[model samples]
Target: MPFFTVIIPLYNKEKYISNAIKSILNQTFTDFEVLIVNDCSTDNSIKIATEFESEKIRIIHHEKNKGLAATRNTGIKNAKANYVAFLDADDLWKPHFLEKIFNLIQNFSEARIFGTNYEEIWDETVKMPHNNSDSLPKDFVGYLNFFKINIKQGIYNHGSVCIHKEVFEKAGYYNENIQLSQDLDFNIRANYHFKLAYDASVQMSYFMQTDNQLTRSSIVNKTIPNYDAYEEWAKSNPDLKKYIDFERYVLGKRLKKNNDSRWKDMIAPIEAKNLNWKQNVLLKLPSSALNLVDKIKLLLLKVGVKPSTY
Candidate 1:
C-alpha cells in the first residue's frame, strides 16, 4: 500500500491542473498514490489529467456535478492509503512536501492530522506568507494548539494537510451540506477529537488568483456552517469558544454587508468581550459603508499591506 493518498478534487481547473499534478509527481517521497476526483467537469480538465502517463495517477469521475465537500468525500471514500492528503486542483505543493509530512508522521505518531505551512500567491506573483508564521515558535514541529494558533488565520491551507484515514472515522467525514467553511467545520471537529501534528515550514503554494475560488465568491448565495451545533460543547472550552467567535465575527461581517437577515443570528452567540472596539464599530456600519471598507481593504492588499479584523 502507498504511504499516502494525495486527493485533488477537480472541477473546471484545466489551466492549472497540469501544474498541480506535476507538483505531486515531483515529490521527493514517491510512496504515494494520486486520486483526481472530477466533479463532472465540462472543461478539458479530465482529459488533461488523463494525459499524465504515471501509473501512480487515477481519475474518478462523478456522474453529475457535486460541490467541493462531496467531491472531497468521494476522494476519501476511494482513497487506498492509510494517510490522505488533499491538494485542490489549482494548488501546488513543493517537491519535498510529502517528505516533510512523512517525517512529521514518524515523529508524531500520536497525531492523527498533520499539516505544513504554506504561502498564498496573489496576482500570480506576490507571495504572502500566512500571518500565523511570525507567531509560530522557532523551529516549531509537534502537536499544535489548533484553536489557539488558528485564531487569527489558519496555519495550514487545504493543500498542506495530511490526515490519517482513521481520522475520518472518528471525527466524521466532511460535512456535505455546508457549501462554505466546510473545511473550518471539519477542522473544528477533528481538533476536538485529535491532536494535529504541524510543521511550521512552508511546503505548498495556494494560488488565490484562480478562477472560481470559493473565498472570492459572494457569501449571499452560500450556506455557512451551522456553528450553533457546537455551541454547547464550546461553552466550557475557552479556546474553542474564542475560535468559533472569531469565525462568527468574520461570517457576520459578510452577512451584515450583504444585508442578510441571518446576520443577527450569526453574531448573537458571540460575547461582546471577545470582540474588540474595531469589530464592534464595523458591525454597526451600514451596508454601503461596509462595502466601501471592503474596497479600501482590497486596495491595501494590492499595496502589500495585510489588514485583518483583529
Candidate 2:
C-alpha cells in the first residue's frame, strides 16, 4: 500500500489542534504518517497532539517560538514517506481528502504536485472560492495551463495540497523569511518544474478565528504586507514576470508607499502594456457621463463581451 506523510505545524492551537489531529487520524486512506512539529507553542497544543499518540503519529519539538515557515520546515525535514501533505493546526480535513488525491496520483502516474478544493469557514460561514480561484481544470496538467495566466490560480490550499518528495528536491523548501504568502510563493516556485493535479474532492473544513469582524480586513493588517514574501520569490523566479505585473501594479497600490523612480523601474520591462486611461481626457469624463458610459457598456456586454474565461 502507498502512504502519504502529512505534516501539521502546531503553534498555540490549544483551541483547535485536537480536531485537526483527529481529522487526520480519521482519514479513509489508512497508510500514512502524521508528524506534528510543536513550534514552541505557549499553549497546550503539544498535550492535545500527544493525546492522539500512536505508532503513526510522531512529534518534532522546536524549543523556541519559530514562526510558521520554520516550523513547517521542521516537518518537511522529518517527513518519512514518498509523498508529503500539510494541514494547519486550526483546520480539519474532510475524511476522504487523502483518498481522492492518492487515487489521482495513481491515475495520473506522472503528477508531482496536486491539490484539492477546501471550504474556508469563518464565523460559521463559508467564503466562496476566490474570485480568481476558479477555472479548476479537471485533469492533471491543470497547473501548466494555469501558469499561462500568471499569478491567478493559487488553488493550492496549504491544508489540502500534497507533493511527491521529489518536489522539494526540485523546487526546494518554503522560504523561511516570508511571514505571509510562503505557501503561495512555494507553489509558484514548484510549478516551474512540476505538473499539478486538480481534484475537487480534496476538501478540508477551515476555521478563521481572529478578533475581527471581517476576516479579510484582519488578514490585510496582520499578514498581507508584514514582509514581501511573494516579492522575494517572484524576484528569484523571473519566469513569473508574465503573470505578476508587480512593478507596474505598485503604481496603483498605496501611492504613499511608492516613489517615482521605483515606479518607473517596474514599468520599464512591460512599457508596451502601460496604457494609462486616467490621464486621457476622453477617458475622464464627468461622473454622470462616466456612469452613463458604464451603463451602456453593460448593455452591450448584456449582448456580449469576452470573458477572461475561467
Q: For candidate 1, write residues 24-45 as lDDT tens digits.
A: 9999999999999999999998
**Per-residue alpha-carbon lDDT of candidate 2 for residues 54-144, written as tens digits (9 for 90 to 100):** 8899898988888898988888888888889999988889989888888778877767987776665644443434323345443433334
Which parts of model 2 have CA positions greater than 4 angstroms off?
Answer: 130-144, 149-153, 209-239, 246-310
Model 2 is weakest, by summed lDDT over 10 consecutive residues, at 251-260
CA displacement after TM-score superposition, residue 227 of candidate 1 (Å):
0.7
Per-candidate TM-scores read 0.95, 0.71
> lDDT per prediction?
0.87, 0.64
